[model samples]
Target: MDISAPSLRAVFTAVKTEFNAGRSTYTPTYTRIATVVPSTTSSEDYAWLGEFSRLREWIGDRHINKMALHSYSIKNKKFEATEGIPSEYIEDDTFGVLMAKFQDMGYAAATHPDELTYACLASGWNTLCYDGQNFFDTEHDVGEGENEKLVSNMQDGALAPWYLLDTRRPLKPLIFQKRKDYQLSAKTDAGNSDHVFMADEYLYGVDARVNAGFGFWQQAFGSKAELTEANFNSAIEKMMGLKSDKGRPLGINPDLLVVGPTNRSKAKALIEAMQKEGGASNTNYQAVEVMVVPWLD
Candidate 1:
């Protein structure tokens, strides 16, 4: 959990080398996978408002509100509202829809073999801001198209990027107490709190899938603690099945899997076990190409 600066740098170096070596000019696409719990009360609405308010308070009201409005407008264009509420307004909120839109546009491309697609899971805290006025009126107003271009710049030759939200759903209770608990635990015993480093509202909403993706890629690529070709191959095979399990063939196979350190460890163990089994069975199989990255704290 206490990843030193040197360790962080080393990881980045490895990531950059792998990414640049496999870098392609192909435009990277992405897929958005998300989960949401429906809101059932005004308190729920207030909860979202409060969370958004907290973000605004941290940066400034003008910035947070504007960004929210702008994001809403962009998404609203695609999702027409039926009455006073926008049709896209699921009880959960618009974040899910925005992510879905990105996926539909192919932003979240797969990282499979043959296709040689690079895949990544991106997450961050409240990196956007909006005012009561037009949401587009801020220094952060990169148009949707421009946002895509910015993300493309980060692909570094991978096929697609998968954006994951690892935060509380809008309208959900803000568990500040849970965050306090983590902080207290971290201060007391480093070994006692594995969840101490877990993200909280203060860090902004990041998706759990981002963690999963990080774990998935590290194991698939053999970039973590254990380095082995067999493990990598097994990881890739499992990913292939996940990508298209229902007999619907996705024309491409992921060449790369992007994941974080925590999930990477889990994925590594899973892949190693699978490989051992396959070796025992004496089956010839190719490993998967994967990349592991840590996007945020």
Candidate 2:
């Protein structure tokens, strides 16, 4: 059978399909529950889920219940309240006039344009990067001593492979909360706790979750390596030839090469070199796309 090279879109689609499959199969600690029980205080306890399937051979209880801390800082080790920040006050001197005008014109702009914009796109970056997945399986989650290998590696200022998914496995390498909702005034302050006048204000809160689970995935330490054609090819080979927890060939066919800005040019050159017909470094000739992740830099 004659076969030409796959299109870039085809290759990317294949990679994304594998990614989605990995996500779909992911067994979060609370996958059995219809609604996650909010931990009044954060704790790593998913024991209520009972015995895990063979699919969860790599995951553990420690990977569950990662709290979505809107008012705390895990990295800085401090309480970072979302409210109490100074907001610019704009007195609508025309409120009375605006209402009268609305009655006549049938339209009145109550909120500012910038305010609406920020409200809509506040979590743009996180949503894009994580594919709209929540970090936690529980509600309003926060915790101490909960260890995530990815977050810990980042905290230690190290570069590690955050994930290596094997679709054949019964368990997914990653599990996201899949939460996507927001309330304009989810947080009620002292003045607005029980009942309040218009003067009492409320703060918006995101129905966000925390990310957990690292044992299900693989971690590679390669940030210290120099960016070169040899290194790039070697990394790909390493990924493709990975072994599972059971020590069998994982058969991981990596199709995307993600890099930081510092190595963008080098990555581009490597991609081009591999795509060039009859090129010395094009032995494998696997079509892998390159993506420069700005946040990685």
Candidate 3:
């Protein structure tokens, strides 16, 4: 194999091709539970998150919509994965494995959003949201003054957590904020790149600026209790009965149930089975789409 500039560039191109192909072949699951919000800055503010208003008759002056200036924010985060192949391997034509690894790198980058989104959700019991409370707390404040009340989106217990989401709205229960999409880059110039000169290896990497946060907490319910018919029904009822600050129904309908692998069988029986184990018709069969992800406990 030639060790010239053209040859090195060609190798980079080949690795990038494998990477792009791997990216295309990977399927992502985050979009079903989160909304993608393209970001233009290092961070974004959601202070205006709770300003949704209801229309009133215009007999008097017209009502105006307003946004709070600095209520909540999510800062974009940097992430990277790097791999290298020794010059000896490329020169000796033994870089086949490195090519496969590059393809896998692409697959990993594509799957990163799912990892982040679900991990953020799994940690929602502690992470604060626009309301200055945990995203899945049992006491999110609603309304104001005498009308103010404490509302809960979480059912607490010592069991594995499951989630119910109303994803039909314009904004899903989770937010995926991306400032830049993952991209492949290389330090392949053997003579020019300091890394190559020092290590005698060509480097390749994928990097992105992205982060995940909670969206409208009203659109999601998290329960750590045993997953049962009674509990599932309670979650559904709770979500459907949620309202906005002004006491208007938010029309939350739980259309997705997300569970970890530990709850796979129960989730299947709750939503995917046509009949119960005892021969009774399963009234909750297919009540919502179930996603048994491996990310949560």
Candidate 4:
């Protein structure tokens, strides 16, 4: 029941240390090349395949370090070069070539659906057009012939770009509460194709550990209830929650709560109340376990 200021601080210190130490490594690779090619189309339809080969080599050279860092297994030998160029050679066709190169190199490339969505989310790109023709109007216009195909591909229901980025930056600390709207803010930029963007519309009410702990206490002790009697029941319920019980109505109270200098006195008062009730009562209820972990600063 009683949550000592020092105890709460210690818990916070542990959490902070864990956060700093926790690291995530995400290695994304594009899908297989054969998967992207339309079976019905003749090989002649893609004459620009050579460009794709060159692109693959370029990407492998540039991203080798990143791939190594993430432990990707792709090697140049895996790339299966075609005998001759296909004939169609449309600008949109290049995407397929890019996909193949990515696969051969073992870089996780987005699925067709994800690819278009990602492009639109990045700066200098748009999935919609006034003419209802092209979905990806890059800062530089893609030729008219391929524009319609790109637009059509996008309308077919591509995944959002942020999804791909999430796969890449799985461990990035996110600011969840401020991102509750579908309309993305201009201030938030995806620094690289691999950087993940926390969706503005999905971040509402989400909090890191500190705020979450505060919320737990507010619900348990801030209610209009008797101090000596109610505090004892609340503390018991709070502990049960931490033990994995639902602790419904009150929800799971945090195992620990941290108090800064500003609120240290208030926290001490609450701890005293719990200590008294726990000592007097015959129940298992006791002082809330609080650990005081100080910030380095």
Better candidate by TM-score, 1 or 4 = 1
Model 1 agreement with the true structure over 49-168: per-residue lDDT tens digits: 211232224553465233222221101001111111121232233323333332222221222211211112232111111212211111212224433211010112122222112122
> What are the per-model numbers of colliding residue pairs?
44, 8, 0, 32
Candidate 2 wrong stretches, greater than 4 Å? 1-202, 217-223, 244-247, 272-286
Q: For residues 146-245, write the lDDT of model 3, one tens digit per residue.
A: 8999999999999999999999878888899999999899888766889888998899999999999988899889999999999999999999998877
TM-score of 2: 0.39
By TM-score, the candidates rank as 3, 2, 1, 4
> What lDDT does model 2 reach?
0.31
lDDT for every model?
0.25, 0.31, 0.90, 0.23
Model 1 TM-score (2 dp) = 0.20
Stretches > 4 Å off in candidate 1: 1-120, 124-249, 271-286
Worst 10 residues of 3 by lDDT: 62-71
Model 3's TM-score against the true structure? 0.96
As a whole number from 0 to 100, the lDDT of residue 109 in candidate 1 is 22
The TM-scores, one per candidate, come to 0.20, 0.39, 0.96, 0.17
- In angstroms, the error of model 1 at 78 is 27
Instruction: Report the CA-based lDDT of candidate 3 relative to the real structure.
Output: 0.90
